[model samples]
Target: MGSAVNDFAGEFDKQRFQTVDDACKLVLKHFYMAKVDLKAAYRSVRISKKLPFRSKLAPGIFHKLSQAVRRMMSRRGFTIVAYLDDFFICERTKKRCAQALAVLIALLRKLGFCISWSKVTDPCQKIVFLGVEIDSTTLETRLPISKLTDLKSELAEFLLRKHASKKQLQSLAGKLNWASAVVRGGRVFLRRIINGIMRLKQDWHKLRMPGEILQDIKWWHDFMSTFNGKSFFLAKVPITSVVTDACKSGAGGFYHSDWFYVNWVEDYPFATQLHINELEVFSVALAVKRWAQNWRGKRIIVYCDKAATVSCMIQ
Candidate 1:
């Protein structure tokens, strides 16, 4: 019955459930914050008017129905970031934060939504929301020490194994993906694991560990051992721009007043094969390699003529 509903249910808008990253973005700059957890959130919604036969909320439709809660919160002019039933309220001042929290609680109670006071937190400079420790004082987010310890143990156990089921690989991938939110540059290390998961033919298959996958896992294990799982919000403005172009014969790019051009040898395999998109991407890569040292610790905007090259970079 659950599978049938999930399979046939209409698609819900992604915006219906605010993402953790988006929530973090909203509260990162605020000095004061609080958390509100709605008790029995799904059960609190009365579904009789929408589905007379069903008394409980179906998992598929809950998010869509929960849009009402978000709308109500927004209409009240509160600076609250909500992910499903959990709400994080942020303000620049303590007084404002307190007022906002009080008003939010009263509103929820008046609307018949139960607030779990035991789980709710008062306004403060630091609070754990959705498993990530958000510290307004430091302007940073971190994975709690307990989560880091558990992740390290899991990675160690996985490394000792020669083969693992597809489910195990997927579970580990999910954990790494979540951890990436608080660990800068962590996503770059996940490519091999994700590729390995894609190659698996069945859930029950115990696939042998690949060298690349093992290398990536080993890197994670070593890096996490000395690394503090904290990421500071940085400004994203591009510090420089590079314009690149490529043709069948050659590829070239310019960084500011400096420019570079490379002509493909007559016997070059890719150029002879007419791999224009590959050459276009290669032009950007070459430019980065040549000028990376000068652009370290800063963002660079790359302009390419081919849409294919841009799409590849985006992915």
Candidate 2:
């Protein structure tokens, strides 16, 4: 599901369940559940030229998507009230939920609608949708423990209160800009995508939906296509170390964010955008190596806005 659609589904999840953690957790909480989705959801919808181009092929895809939605409304005797293919059926028994799932899946299939089996949840007490946790009994998806952990990390310096050398935002502007510079850049698209990532940064503010996750997966896939061995973006520059941080940026401007991978440093392709900070860090890392060639012990301190790059030190 896309981010916008995920938002609606996420709301349903919170209203239906108490909390959302992971898909596995969801299965454990709900006695019986069903995840119904329209097959080929994006492809099925007929695109309208009026819809401006969003993603790479979103325009044409959405054009067909509109048609699919129309067909869904007229042919299936059901309209996508969720604005997507997710339909909720309340039942007391597993048999009923399974029946619902089977019926919904088959019905969409018959209408030539495709669904993402990977995303579908089958009869569970604990389920997560759009990063929201659901508890069937309480049906109030609240924030998880991990969100607190993430908030701690982002606000580490801010919470420290020492604030001696880092008083001005300009001195720390590099850190502030790190995440957005690389992730929100032109093609690299440092946005959160919900496809493959396993966990969040422990901050609800950093939550991502399907759109960011999907974009991330595409970038990685394209990255693999572009290279065979370990791809490096900066080679000529001397090696140096720097700390990196990243986050998403929106109209709210709560934190400095950009769409990026958890392991952005190693995973990002060499061909992708070479942010100034990344280049600086690369220069330092390389320069240190060159300088330490004759020495046995060498210490390096690297900081960055890119979580992936910074994660390297921890790993």
Candidate 3:
């Protein structure tokens, strides 16, 4: 029902969590942040009589309503970062933060919205919003301890099972998707699980968990166990540019004055079987492997002629 109703609503310009991260960067150090939650957010908004469904919340329609709230808040000059019903008010000082929070609460009340007072946080240097902990003092975002522990526990349970129902896999995928907002390169690891979900024919179907899926789960579990989950808000400027290309016989790339090339051996198994797109990706991979050490802790832009390769890498 959601999928069908969402089509009529079209695409939404919803604010991403990354935007919050970026907002944190602008006010790094000694900033106060507080979160305000709207009580029963979607239910608070009235549905139009013109719409077909009137009882439950339609995500698409709700999003449009949320955007109006965001624009109103922006026009009022509140430094707010919002995702749906969650709003994080950012300010340079505790006093200003408190003032903004007070005014926001009053304004929202006047607008016929109820605040979840228990969920509201006072102005502080750090606050948890949308499950991600944002620290203004350190200018970093991370999954809170509770979220990390829960994720690890779930993954551990999956490791003991030989298979999982489609619903179970989908639930886990959603959690991982949320956690990926703070975990670097986390989405890359989710490809296998997402692919598995796509292959399911029914919600009750059981997927025999593959070795690769188990490996990914284990990797996530181990990583979270020790990782602090901190992702800094500092943006790295690209210092190096790489141009890469590939042919049927070989692949080559150059960075600055240095160059590297690899020639496919006569017995190369994929020489005749791989498509040009695959070779293009391989060329970029080779380039990274060749110079990753030098580029460590810095950013680099890669130039690839193949649009397919670029799209694949972006994903």
* Collision count of model 1: 0
User: Compared with the true structure, what per-residue lDDT tens digits does model 3 show for residues 1-315?
Assistant: 324443465455554333455455446578888878999885677767656663223554565665666677778877676667777788888998898898888877888888999999999987877777888777778887887888889988999999999899999998988888788778888889999998885678899999999898888888877888678764446864789998888889999899987777653556557898998998888888889888764557899888999899988
Residue 160, candidate 1: C-alpha displacement in angstroms: 3.2
**lDDT for residue 123 in candidate 1, whole number 0-100:** 91
Winning model by TM-score: 3
Report how far residue 20 has shifted in candidate 3, in Å. Answer: 5.4
Cand. 1 TM to true fold: 0.74
Q: Write the per-residue lDDT of candidate 1 for residues 232-299, one digit (tens) a residue.
A: 75444675568999887888888878898877874345565657888888888888888988776456
lDDT of 1 at 218: 90
Clashes of each: 0, 77, 0
lDDT of each: 0.78, 0.40, 0.78
State every prediction's TM-score relative to the real structure. Answer: 0.74, 0.32, 0.78
Error of 2 at 152 (Å): 4.8
Report the C-alpha displacement of residue 79, candidate 3, in angstroms.
4.3
